[model samples]
Target: MSVEETMNYVLKIPWHDIERNLISRVQLKKIIKLRIILDKREINYPIYFYVGEKRDHVMIPYVFCSCKNFTIRVMSKKKKPSCKHLIMLRLALDKSMYREIYIDDLTLLKKIINEIIRIGLSPTLRKLLYISRNRRYERGRTDGA
Candidate 1:
């Protein structure tokens, strides 16, 4: 088996154990520096943001992360199931290690939307998509006149 495949096989094992013992020294160091921000404005369910050095990554606990590492390695390559930010988030949430901070819903939504657009979509794609949306809205307004 190749190195990538071997690592993939190794990481497919139970995450907690691997995360605790096998996570790289660099990742371990980064784990402590990462921040988990919990937005509990909605009592029914809360939103989590993994605040990284360069950007904030939105995640739903074990489900997702908006980082390139998660998108490239975990999702596309399948070489690893979770990124360092994700592991830090899971640990913080389960252990209640995260500090609660209040950010109004509107501000939080703005941050989420901006971050997602910045990282989730390429510039050309974003321009094309938003331009099309504006054109559609203009057409609808004209049609109603």
Candidate 2:
């Protein structure tokens, strides 16, 4: 199903029902315990930070998450459209389940950048570089010939 459809479905139904079917026990636990901080200073686009047991993840609601689960499973393998954090955020928004913490936009951006630096380049970035190098090589060969 499309992202929109999935989000709409989740929003329409209660979290309890959706939790039983879609979320695993471990994910459910995280959802309950996770601290969601919202930086809504930017009126057009709000930033969400999900503080998990081990690490903090930067998310853009339903759009993206800095978690490995999202990068590997959702983006790389296509096993799922979203990670537990994203689903939790969606549910939280609908049911008012999250704790609203105020963070300034600049600090939030710095935190997100730091998180990315700590995690290093993702698989998508490596793939993009590889493709770019191959294109340069192909162009060079044609010009040399």
* Residue 127 lDDT in candidate 2: 39
For residues 3-27, write the lDDT of model 2, one tens digit per residue. Answer: 6744554455556656653344334
Q: Which ten residues in a row have the lowest lDDT in candidate 2?
A: 27-36
- Please report the candidate that would top lDDT against the real structure: 2
Per residue, candidate 1 scores C-alpha lDDT tens digits across 93-125 of: 544655333333455455554755577523332
TM-score of each: 0.50, 0.53
What is the alpha-carbon lDDT for the whole of candidate 2? 0.56
lDDT of 2 at 93: 62
Span of ten consecutive residues with least summed lDDT in model 1: 28-37
Cα displacement (Å) at residue 14, model 1: 6.9
* Residue pairs with backbone atoms closer than 3 Å in model 2 (clashes): none
